[model samples]
Target: MSALRIEGYVIVSADGMLANAKHVMPDSLRFKGDQEFFNAALDRTGLIVHGRHSFEGQPNSPKRKRLILTSKTAALAADPSNPNAVLWNPAGATFDEACDCAGVRSGTVAIIGGPEVFAMFLDRYDTFWLSQAPHVRLPGGQPCLPGVPERSPQAILAAHGLKPGEPQILDASHDVSVTPWRRAG
Candidate 1:
């Protein structure tokens, strides 16, 4: 079997915030370009992994095959409501075990986020697609990664051995751009 490759997808404000102080993703961070790009990438993934908030924030989330990371679960457990989802506690079970429980044998695993989930896979991502809304800034907002406001996302990626690629303009009207950060050799 092929190794399971992990990829991350996130959009942040100029200040590196994924959500406001209330832990809500604001409309300011939403862009047509970013949404389209994100949807396309996620559609190809064998499985999606994220926190509860991230799952709910997404549209049509129940239709996707995913693992919802949550402390409420002791380990990997099937979601009663959604047959396509699994509830997982990282501390209770290994990621590989979670994948087995989720029935995703091997393929790209898309790691979408709520900060902690993003941080957990820092060392595992084959490519992290970092999209930015450069004009939006959220003070006292929830960071995309744990160290934001103290450290820039670029710095955090570099520290984890990821290198940024050329950013492509996704939305010229909103100045939304996406840069793919790949694991450095």
Candidate 2:
């Protein structure tokens, strides 16, 4: 398999839910800094890969190429709804093929997520930019990653050889912060 530098970006609540129970980003978690950080990070990404659920309700659509990962796509094909988007099934197409379908040649690819999307790239991420709102906790929210009920996000990333850097405050008043988890040298 060819090596691809896939980076990830996510925002979570303290209890480790990427979204609330309704599977939507909570209004309480919205912050300008997190949005800005993600946008700036995307500037370095050549292609984006995200889950179908996350794509359907996106607030900020990407102007660049994207590959929406979905089980619904039996074959790799262009996404009908998006000009610069492709629908990809990893089992049906190689990463390179999917990138080609999305018109991306090479460079960093950003893995934006729902839990399933995040889990798919556990060992693939070169770095994961994790933003958090520590003040908020969604009691019955969706977990950050699936199949890792025994582990915290930190432990799961650590198992995948990712080491988190010191959390940098995104918003002091709201206790929003971001940590970059890099593949350890």
Candidate 3:
């Protein structure tokens, strides 16, 4: 069987901007407990799927299989150094097929994102790991899951048949929360 997971590190303001899309990292925003959470997530993931922007944002790494989902013609040429990187266009192959080809299988296939990618696989994902920043602000930026209505994350997850599973508060330093959700039936 195939398994899909949607995971993201998001920081949203009260008004709801996830983070600055233009900047490498958002302005005045810290990762909080992201390092530890991300490390754990990576350990469970067999393959990492991400948008071109998210792929580019990553620092150099030789480990893990990274797939970039894009419709661009010059996709591979854009990142020649990373030979392990593969460009997957949904037009050519569905996300599931690509993950299978990359040996994702029953193991976790983490779909990291830039909104559109999250939207595409929302219905298909069986798990979602969300890093919720309690008190943070990004004045002018894109939302973690744009086009998703102004509702609490719990409400949104419930609507999608995903219920919170394990939640760990990352201390009180950054006021961030890490929660994992599983699809219900």
Name the top lDDT candidate: 1
List lDDT for all candidates, in order: 0.91, 0.81, 0.63
> If ranked by lDDT, best first, what sequence of candidates would result?
1, 2, 3
**Per model, how many backbone clashes are there?**
0, 0, 0
lDDT of 3 by residue, 81-156 (tens): 5656677778777666666656666677677776777667666667777766667655556766655437655566
- What's the lDDT for residue 10 in model 1? 91
Model 1 C-alpha lDDT per residue in residues 1-185, reported as the tens digit of each score: 24899999999999999999999998888898898899888878889999988863457556789999999989988899889999999999999999999888999999999899999999998999999999999999999999998999989999999999999999999899999999998
TM-score of candidate 1 on Cα atoms, chains taken together = 0.96
Number of the top TM-score candidate: 1
Q: List the residue pairs that clash in candidate 1.
A: none
Question: Compared to the true structure, candidate 2 yields what TM-score?
Answer: 0.91
Q: List the residue pairs that clash in candidate 3.
A: none
Error of 3 at 36 (Å): 1.4
Better by lDDT, candidate 2 or 1 = 1
Tell me which of candidates 2 and 3 scores higher on TM-score.
2
